[model samples]
Target chain A: MNKKWMSITVSLVLVFTLLATACSNKEKNSGGSTAKEGGKGEQVTITHYTIDSPDRTFVEKLIPDFEAKHPNIKVKVTKAPYEQFDSKLQSSIAAKNAPDVTSHWGYGGFMEYYNKEMLLDLTPYLDGFSGSDYNIPEDVMNIYKVDGKTYGIPLNSYVTVMLYNKDLFDKAGLSYPPTDYEDKSWTFDKMVEYAQKMTVDSKNLEEAQYGVDFGFGERDQRPQYFGAHVYSDDTWSNGGKPSEINLTKLEVVDAYKTIYGLIYDKKISPTPAFSQTVSGQYGDPFLSGKIGMSVVGSWSLAAAADFSFNVGVAAVPYNPNGDVRSVLYVDPLFVLKDSKHPKEAMEWIKYLITTEIQEKSIELSGGNPPVNQAAAEKYYNNFEGIEPKGIQQVFDGAYKYGFESYNHLISNYSQINELFINELAGVENGDKQVENVLPDIEKKLKDLLARVNK
Target chain B: MREAALKESANEVRRMRKWKLSQIIGFVILLLVTITMLSPVWFMVTTSLKTTKEMLVFPPTLIPKVFAWGNFSELFTNTDIKFGQQYRNSLIVSIFTVIGTIISSSFVAFGFARYQARSSSFLFMLVLSTLMLPYPAIMIPQFLLFMNLGLHDSLLPLILPSFFGSAYMIFLLKQFFSTLPDELYNAGRIDGCSEFRLYWNLTLPLAGPALATVAIFSFIWSWNDLLTPVLYLDSQENFTLPVGMAAMLSSKFRLAPWNLLMAASILSVLPIMLLFAVAQKRFVEGIVLTGIK
Candidate 1:
């Protein structure tokens, strides 16, 4: 009896354990299958990964509409946080589980994705897509092309413009910066002169208020205004060949000295150390009204709305070469190379860039200028409410004289930029002069470019 | 003698006073350290309750003037976030991970503790060596293996790995099991207890503290895991809390809604906090017992 009982107990335990494992496995399988299934046979589910944004409401509202129209298709939108999205996307692609469609910034090593063959050449999709039906401009669409093959569709674009605090300008008794794109009076020298006048300091040289701030770092805008082409040629745009660093050029060196002087010599902008003390306490020095003006992107409009005093916009301070240029950034949506449902992804991208969707997205996002020229014009004109004075400058700056930022075209951009920034940090901090460090910066850039290109 | 006794008492009073002063100083330092350590958490709670305008105000406020309980309500009511679904997913994954880790690690630890084999030491060392291998080093191979198993986008990838036993957990359990008196096992065998029965009824019941430690650790680890879920789970519906919260915090075009993000963060951390609170006594006892033995 004892033997029989023991054996029975052991057998029962084994049976139960196996049963449990089997049940769990079955549950997992069922859960996976249910998630995979759309509704019926031949229903395609396209998963799109995108950065989380306040404008995400538009996408969320539109997905159901898209699903209703295409009964046989389902769209799953996954948003990764902006900071982690790039690394997350890379890991997902490495795992061979990349989303069908993803949002990408059109600059800053975007070609690395194309070069690695991770992006689907959407030229064929664009051909089938009634191109003329959408009001998206050729220039905007061309931004996403690599070697004559289109890979992405421009979803939204923004221009960097001068955001000046009107209250601060009044306190300094200075006239408002020119809002017109063609205003030659709004030159780099004029901006510096205004900054010098506005900067206030105590006897101890403790700045009570800074003259001006570049919400982006000085490296981003100064090089552009001075026409210091980092690349040898326009290879970044045309995709012809790799180019060498042009930091040794007189124009580049002069731009660096002028910007560095603003921080260390002129003491018009807050240093990195001073900025750290007030971190998280204010949105930005410019918005906080501690600075007279800031060269910032159109996205700053959202923050501008909340300012206690009035805010105004102007075209970025111009170069001496009789050209007014500002940095333009285009956020695009691309179809992944390994997507099983490329056609569906293309359809979604097409839907995103339509004039109606673009206009609505701009309206919903509260100032992301549309890529479609007509939609952009419509958005600018129909915009309601207490507009930030000279808001038209954003559109004018974009359409007339916007150029890609320095790092936008280079494949090894991050590495090269890091080296430049580290060298420039010394200049900014008064530890080294621009003339003294330019040689080292030039050498490091060349070595990095060579290594990366090789 | 009476005079000497009085003098000693006076000295004792002086000594006690000095000791009391030192203790007060130590207490103040500890209080400061504690506040410093906990300030970030306090900021998170307060920020969650502050309006966007208040958040961007110069010189941040410690206590919000108008508490925005609406942020929490918005988190729950937002259809797009699916916070409740993510919370459930996290709970399910964490519970399974705890059960699996306890069961698998205890089983393996028992073998290492009880058995005497020719290569037992070598095999045990081999298990310990796996602790040196970083998760990222083997992440690709493991991902590929799961992909091949058709478990790419499911919580199975997160849960199933716990069943195989972790080297660290096994090491901890082995250390614990080895401290058990061997005569109990010998006596059980003489009375006709099988090895499996010994493990199931006798040994496991006595291993309450160790098992509790393993359970709590597993639960916390699985609950806080962001990367594994982000890699495996593609859809938001299947996302765990950490992944969901991360998604909510990320925005490229504009700054994240900090108030809402903080509210979601508070919600995500509450479960682990509650678990720790409930298990605090046992958890401490487990660690103390493990250390002593």
Candidate 2:
């Protein structure tokens, strides 16, 4: 080779080697984490993967206390932004390098973890362990059981409730919606009647006050409330393996049409387009105080903290003939199957649920209710800007009649939901008739289910 | 003679008037376009200074009703976020990335431009083919590879990849370098200068614009990158700017402090804007000279 060619090759190799060595040196210093002197029994550093939220913040704050209590086990909290958190966890699990402990919001996810057999069944832990921290409610405990095996514990929950503007109700001279779920007078039709009274005719979405904002496009949870099924129960039973879309069924169509009518015909609820105009950065129209009532989850309580008027919590309007089902969001924390230190991870999960910690969960998290009954009781009673009795009734109402939507229970739900969420938008926005679109939605949904089920 | 002179002066005056009028119109049109383009940046600046409550107000106020000076302070002082540390981390990674990418890509580009071998075309095609490998397809394998190297949680995974040379940058720099005369390299070799010296002393000084372009693009890409940092860095202390900024937004499930997010965004953008301002001349020249979009 020519001298120039030889010299060039040597320099390139040297440069790369120099950079790679520098990086390795840096990595060496960062990775050589010696046994934390304060810890006992050869300090074990366990990574805790959590999504960014009050829950993650709650975990981060407890890290020091956890480490101090269990000196042998070092707790390292890793919070990926919510968008990346699940994907990263899945990647780590696939790589067999999953974090020792992690959590997910079960209403939208975490079922996949169970379905894929990625979670460590916590039943064995519950059997061998004895502690007051594990005093979760019987119903909640039943939820954790997958084929009689305890899978996880719910750390926090977001129960669906009716967030009403008391000021609007009073201005219209209407009585507050009954907080007691048992009140037969407080029917679905009755709530709509009250809404019609308060809805002021306006020039546009900005000037006009919407009587209700039922979060139509966010997810049409209306079918569950109407005692209607969008799909057969067998589909949910089969974990969505042989699902059928019943969106064209009379009862299901009625449920969807009722909400659709509310936006276009009745003109009480805000249209998806209307809400877009009024929603600020948070996309919350209810917080603007222009709406009479909003049927949404309790997670919205944090956003309502700064409301200019009084807010009331009430049991969501229910179908008297149908089952009184409300969307109950249970966010659980579980140990990964691949966790190297399952015992240490279990220790961390248990410590987070002690009465002291659970009680502070509501206070620290701003608004997310703890699944622990005591802390949850405190959260429902005397919530920010809400009537204590009304909020309690609503909380009780959800617990008594709460059922997770089939979407939450099924595997491949994200994929299934993606298929029709956009196609169903035209019906949701009132531009297309429900009768005309249901057939197409069913076809597309079936296609997706067939593809995903295999 | 006197009449002709007067007529010439009048014509000159008319010509100047026409020229001045069009210039005024062009200036006005460009000013409007610039303002139209920068409105989002302006909104970010204004929103960063507004309270979260005020930011939500429709018909958003161009000027915040109340100046929230606290948003900037809160970005650093907020117990949960380590914006200051992240800012420093981003700088460290981006600077090293620029240095590594410029050196490696240029060296590789020089070989392709000036050197020849029987396998040269085949090897160049091989490098180019790597650009076709989608990130999603290879991300898992690359992540596993890094995990085995014990580099997963460190900033090394983020910076190490750039040193091996990137296909796009090498391609861009090669196009620019091939235009330079072979005589310069030959003369340097005739004087007994080694290949390293020729690259350093003779070729590099002339390739400043292309290198600056690569430097700018690499810095911006590294600075703005969210995926690598999110995948690699687990600890908050090592997070880059984009990851740190995203963490501030919270998520859809909860209330995001947009005011605080906007403030962090403005702060993060300062370095890039300053870079563009400083290297404005060369960056434009590099893109034009390299003929690479």
TM-scores, chain A, per candidate: 0.85, 0.88
Residues forming the 10-long window of minimal summed lDDT in candidate 2 chain A:
A27-36
How large is the interface RMSD of candidate 1?
5.4
Model 2, span A1-454: residue lDDT tens: 3567558757866765675676555532122122344433467677777765654667677788888898788777777787677667766766667777776642245556677787888877775654334567777655555676777777776677888989899999999887888887787788888899988757655568878877522353567677777777775445445456688899888877887888888999877666766675347878667889888877777666666578878877767757754777777787878776677778888888877787766677666677777666677653666766677778888878887654556666666676667887887677899889888878887877677566
The residue pairs that clash in candidate 2, if any, are none
Candidates in order, TM-scores: namely 0.87, 0.90
Candidate 1 stretches greater than 4 Å from native: A1-43, A67-73, A91-96, A105-108, A128-133, A197-208, A215-222, A237-241, A248-250, A280-289, A306-309, A321-324, A381-389, A406-408, A412-447, B288-293
Taking the candidates one at a time, how many backbone clashes does each contain?
A: 2, 0
On TM-score, the candidate that comes out on top is 2
Error of 1 at A40 (Å): 12
- Local lDDT at A272 for model 1: 62
Candidate 2 residue-wise lDDT, B1-293, digit = tens? 99999999999999999999999999999999999999999989998999877876665779998999999999889877778999998998898799789888999998998889999999999999999998878888988888788777777788888989999999989899899998988888899999977777777778989998999999999999988788877777778889888776655656677788899988998999999999989999999998876
| Candidate 2: regions farther than 4 A off | A1-43, A106-108, A128-135, A170-174, A197-205, A216-220, A240-242, A280-282, A429-431, B1-31
Query: Per-residue lDDT for A1-454 in model 1, tens only?
Result: 5467567657755754664455335423211112345547577777777665556545766788788877776777766655556666776677667778876532234566665577888888766664456766677667777778888777777777777878888988999887777777778778889998888743232346777776542363456666665456666654523566677778877777777678877888867655555444333555446678887776676555556468777777766763536677776787888788888788878878788878777777666777776686655654334353456665676567876554544565656666766877787667888888888877876777677666
CAPRI docking class of candidate 2: acceptable
